[model samples]
Target chain A: MSDHAKVIKKHHDHHAHAIAKPGKRLMHHVPLAFVLKKVLGHGGRNVNTALNLTSYIDFLLVTVIFLLMSFSAGGEITVDKSITLPNAENVEDVIEAPMVAVNGQSVMVDGTPAGNTRAIRDAGKVQKVDELFELLKRKKELWSSFHPDKAFPGVAILQVDVDVEALVVKSVFQTAAFAGYPNISFMVRKRAKAGGGEGG
Target chain B: MGGVDVGGGGGGKRAVNAEINMIPFIDLLMVTIAFLLITAVWVTNSRMNANAQVPGPPNTEPTEVTTPEKILHLHIEEFEFKLVWQQGSTVVAEDKVPKQEQTDKEFVKFGDLAVKIAEQWQQHGGHQDPSDQKTDQCVVHADNKLPFRELVGVLDAIYDKKREQNQADGTIKNVPVFNMSFSIR
Candidate 1:
């Protein structure tokens, strides 16, 4: 062939493969090359997908709004999974306080096991719970020391189980009162209302 | 130039549409979602407060008996609730509402103690006459063995009390009744 024709043919060959470079190819030396080859039909075409982000962006927006609405910045409390808190309609805003959790069979102060509920109940009379009392007293002292400027807000949260006896509640409550934390907040679940506010 | 027009501002005509890079926007949104999802707390916890009714410390040196003013008291028993109104040392009024056990009903209702309490309040001219604020508050004496759920039910019944409020603007408003507290003997 003539030199001019040969040069033109070489340039055309290079231009024919303009979509890809000379050696680089997709799935080159890929793991499970046989499986990939079998999955992709012999069309000799590179799979190019146009990501439809509209729906994804919409999902993200809804999620973000939901999070924003339900966001709690206090980080002051966590739900005790051991006990099921009673549901109530008349509720006030939650306050940050040391929680004294009492269950059907146990008593815990700030997640630490303190006393037994069954023994106290078996005794069958009004009495003071010593372990709970001491823990609360120490908690009160700590609260007093840390925020010296503010008045010791003598507030305590009682995370008691719904099935627990009032006697157990009374003992723990009495102990807390004796500890000088008089203002008590009974932790409860917000009762769900019917006929509305349920966003399906 | 980028969206819909598809020209990407490559030609002589000035691009009417601004090409906004959505990659960064999506990246930012993803990060925000991750942060929120990681930190989101699902427990819708709430509180029912029993403010400052500390039954006196263990045992103390004998002191002078303090005169308390008018107050509402609900002593929760196993099968009944003793509703009493007291002033100083004397009880102004007292009533009983027997609790009903759950039969076909899903929950144990305290059986309309609101009407009884209202009647008692009207007859006694009930209000907070703050001689000693501590004593003037409504005290709930729930028995040790009584389940906490019943106590909550009693609270729910009484919490429905609404007092008619006369505003300066010539409008009437309804306000909640006396706030309740707890007491242990």
Candidate 2:
């Protein structure tokens, strides 16, 4: 054989030696400790680091999804008026439109009078219960007219004063219910202050 | 024991490995924040009524302005409904719906008041001139302590009655929200 042919034969032998026998390969399992030591450094510290990374990624993913859900609400319907709303201990966040103050005597729609001249204090004069129906009916009509495609706003915020009796507040809800507006939300401050320290 | 050299493998070597790749986490957080902000903004803008047209100037001399009618302001004290109006205000009409004196329920007399207001609103002269119909806006000045329910009931009654009227007549009646202002006492 020529020198080049001899060199080629040696190279072919080396390549053949590199390929393992088919049946032996199945039995050639790396030791668990060997694999662990190689991948996770000497004392399993690297394994913990990798596990922490995986868990951290999971935590971040979950947090992202949670936050996305929290921040996606549209412009909040707000009622910026003088009427102070009664606070509740079991308060929940509710979406609403401009508030219509009902002090049990007079009705104010968006802080404007939409009813009779009934003083709140005078028990026999103004029929507030009857007036609420009128106000809700008007609001419903206005909303329907403006948003004729059934896009009328749903909830009405009632900023009933803290001193207003529960019966009066309940009447407001009843009026809203009758007016076909089922969602009536009581307005409240973030941090309770004033006379209503808790459970007003 | 399978005669494998397990004991000879270096198990005593210690190494510290606490470093973490925070790049992916930071990237994910940024993406999430951006997504939430965009969704919130989109939702907010979708609610804005962009098609609402501004009211233009009155076409000609207003009709209700010429009559100078006086509006009767009613006050609901603890027990009575009192009527109030300025001296020069034109007294269109004033009548009260008598209620059961013993009733403790704070129900607003919306239906009767609505009928009265509807009649008053209809009575305002719009038949004389076609141009004066849109300009007649009722100005209501209310006491501060009025119940929110009662007030809404009044507005609701006015709206319901008028809509009922329009539905009955089969003519589209656009009832303007009578301009209502408050005297916060």
Candidate 3:
């Protein structure tokens, strides 16, 4: 072969080899090596890689924070942490703690009757009258103590019969408020007209 | 030429390459948000234990009273309330509170019952004097299903006379009826 022709053939072979393995191979090697190499072996290569890591970590951290905040903000209010309230045919939307339940002649505290069976029928025995007030006073103190940052004189929840006389129900409030729980609330079944039914 | 070539290649080495893959980050965020929402809901749910056995405070003994006036015992039934004032076997008065129209009436049904009771109370020595008084207390036998607000309203009506008298006498206003008690069956 002629000298110029041989030189030209060798140059063509070298160019073909270069084309076979381009900067993509170098890029793949650099990224992998950047992950493996430390300050000792690859002088600051890991530090350069750390810059990318920081961006992803920041994204993860911000998202986590946002989620935590949203979770706390979306807390719900429930009765005894269990009973999803039932909608009533006639009532209002009122949420109260210490929900006093009055089923028939029974006077219940946190849904448990305070008096006995005979009293449940007659509902006139003054035997267990003081117990309800005493319980209420203690609860008022506890609620206040729970949120020591502020001052709440007392807390009570009064639930009465739908057919109960306004005067009779009023006397109950007067009695409770007189016992020092001026901050009282009433539990009512929301009127089922609106879509705000007390379901989950 | 060499520096220009390097600068042209450096366009691919932009600092924004370190930015997180936003799609994966967003996916994780959504999952985390859902998890937080569920947890918050759970935590808030366990707050009120409706089944908890919260009993009324225990009473040691009943105290003796000097003057024992007839006590009006009110029984709250499902559809109506029965009021009876009695001491021993003698029934002073027994009246049933009727059910009023409640479909569109803003006021509660038995609201008039309170008024009637108040009128009767006025007729029967319903004097309000902070200095001295007659009967020790008036015990109300309330039903467990009645709403607390109604109970308060009833009490307010019952004590309206005393409140008015107190206002006239210039005592610290809004004084609650101290001579009231409850008998929850």
How close is every model to the real structure, measured as TM-score?
0.68, 0.29, 0.33
* lDDT leader: 1
Worst 10 residues of 2 chain A by lDDT: A191-200
Q: Candidate 3: TM of chain A?
A: 0.40
| Candidate that beats the other on DockQ, 1 or 2, i.e. the better one | 1
Better of 2 and 3 by TM-score: 3
Candidate 2 lDDT at A40 equals 50
Per-model root-mean-square deviation over C-alphas: 12.4, 21.0, 15.7
lDDT per residue for candidate 1 within A52-129, as digits (tens), equals: 777888888898888888888866367678787776655666887888898877889889887999988898976788
The residue ranges of model 3 lying beyond 4 angstroms of the native Cα positions read A1-200, B1-65, B78-80, B101-109, B125-127, B130-138, B142-162, B165-182
Q: Is the docking of candidate 1 incorrect, acceptable, medium or high quality?
A: acceptable
Candidate 3 chain B: 10-residue stretch with minimal lDDT: B45-54
Give a tens-digit lDDT track for model 2, residues A50-127: 233556567777877777666745455444444454322223344546566755356667767754323324443223
| Candidate structures ordered by TM-score, highest first | 1, 3, 2
Candidate 2 stretches with Cα past 4 Å from truth are A1-59, A69-75, A79-98, A102-107, A111-118, A123-126, A129-137, A144-157, A166-200, B1-25, B34-185
State candidate 2's TM-score: 0.29
Clashing pairs in 1: A167-B144, B1-B17
* Candidate 3 reference-contact recovery: 0.13
Q: Please, what are the lDDT tens digits per residue for candidate 1 over residues B83-131?
A: 8888877987788887664322223345456556656555654452322
Ranking by DockQ: 1, 3, 2
Chain B TM-scores across candidates: 0.58, 0.40, 0.45
Quote the lDDT for A32 in model 3.
Answer: 61
DockQ for each candidate? 0.38, 0.05, 0.09
Give the per-residue lDDT of model 3 (tens digit) for B32-119: 7667656764322111101111234587899576554666665656666676767655877777776442433323334455555655
